[model samples]
Target: MKTVYGPYRSWRLGYALGVDPICRQPKVCNLKCVYCRLGCGGIMVTERGRFVDEDRVKEEAKEILDKEKVDVLEFRGTGEPFLAKNLHEIVRALRGLTDVPFGIVTNGTMLGRDDVRKELKDFDVIVVKLDAVDEDGFRRTNRPHHSITFERTLAAIRDTIAESKGDVIIQVMFYKGNVALADRISELVRDIGPSKVFLSTPQCPEIPGLSKKELTDLVELFSGMDVRTIYTECAKER
Candidate 1:
């Protein structure tokens, strides 16, 4: 894919025009989640660095905005967008050209980093991944690097929601292995108080998903919490 990918149908973000800020030779990310769309192979690194040309991203985004009509502009492509150092610059550059609402889909690992959180605070919508809460649960689902811990990531997510000037949507993926964490993750939703929560499962690897009835039951688990489950169907059709 080029610097930009899709105005693809986003079950959550509407028609999203995607911009890839991490366009290196091979995709690099922090976690190897069981449900990743990028397949089950890549470099897992936590180091923050510039991986793409900010000027190129700006040029592509401006060109797209001038040509197509999209419901939202998103910063997500090959890898963890937060790792891309030029993200803030790209967002500012695109903001100068169009008023389309911007959203970012990130793993939430870098939210504790002052620079990452500060740069991402101004987006219109931010999707923070919260697949698991505890260490074992995280290991089963997210399968993050040895350095990342559940407590730090959870705390950073809370901080991001508290400081974000826009909407925050907690994205959780449920599979057979991590299904037991439903209650714990719900408690997190109650604590973080995000505007919305998206519960989904992998479509690429075709993992077993919670049935519709099970999803309904899961929603009931968070009955009184100040959160809404946007996508109830776990096994979404491609």
Candidate 2:
């Protein structure tokens, strides 16, 4: 199967080449997020292994780059890209194969490690998932690995953003469970200082989200901050 899938339309990142760094049949990730498009059968796999071969990934990238007029190379695997031990090697290999800008959509769990953060800084853009600001919210929403606490992930997010060299986008998925945490999430966002904040609802598994009025209010709440809703991008296209 082709590891690199689409130059799919993404409102946030623009035309991009999607890269899957993992190889599991069902695929494995660190979070069993309720809203994951992959569904909740998601497992919390933290082992650092070579999910896919770097040479094969490079070949796949070359084939797509030759045909697609993509704006960027987005590393969004079926699972977390960072969980793959040689992600940086894959990144380096792809750079040699093409000149497209690189970006990654990560769950931010592995960012707790210094090496992961260092390796990640090489990308042109980084989108981190921050669905909850507290432990209770974390368990209910993300269902992260038992070993990783909310505090650790939050600290990693803050620390990574504080020192990240690339454009940082903190994505907060607002579902029925953590919608109330918007204000608190805003507070935390203010403290962390990301380049942009992406407010979105589950586009998969079809979870309940804030109503139009509520979403408008949530956008207003982050008015001072550089916040944008997923729908805002859609509205522009329309």
Candidate 3:
């Protein structure tokens, strides 16, 4: 599979080009999120390793950048981006090749590590996932690895927001499991104080999404913060 793909239009990132660092079959990720569009069939790993060739990624990226213009170069794909140990190296190489800002869509599991945070600072935009506030809600929504915990993930997200030089966006995927905890989730979002908050729901048929009215009700809770919702963006496109 190609490491570089898509100049696809995104609701949050606009016309985004994606770089798949963990370009493996059956997917390789630490979390087995219940609402994951990728589904449950994948390797669950906590340790980071070099999954893709840096030179090959650079070559593909250069070819695409030379030919097509994109709003942002996003590091995300079939698995957790932080699982690739050579992520920093890949990001550094690509940075020199293109002036287009770098972005990453991560689960925030690896942000606890000092090295991870240090390397992530190089990116221009960071979009981290925070689906639930408490342990029960967390486990139910994001069935993470045995080694990962709610407390650690939450703390790491807080620290990442505090330390990041670029825009740190908190992406909350509200579903039947976590909708009731919206107020608490909003409180945590306020406490973390990200550059923006993206409210979303799983688009997959298996996982039901909230109605437009239900999602609209959440807007007031995130008052004073820059907020965007999937529903509102859909309406904008119409």
TM-scores across all candidates? 0.89, 0.92, 0.94
Q: lDDT-based ranking, best first?
A: 3, 2, 1
Task: Please give the distance, in angstroms, between residue 92's alpha carbon in candidate 3 and its true position after superposition.
Answer: 1.8
CA lDDT of each candidate? 0.78, 0.82, 0.88
- Per-residue lDDT of model 3, residues 158-203, tens digit only: 8888878899999999988889899999999998899999998877
Q: Which ten residues in a row have the lowest lDDT in candidate 1?
A: 229-238
lDDT of candidate 2 over 87-148, digit per residue (tens)? 89899899887776898989888898877977976699999999888899999998888998
Best by TM-score: 3
Residue pair clashes in candidate 1: none
What local lDDT does model 1 show for residue 67? 82
Better of 2 and 3 by TM-score: 3
lDDT of 1 by residue, 110-154 (tens): 888888867876588999888877888888788899998888998
Model 2 residue pairs with clashes: none
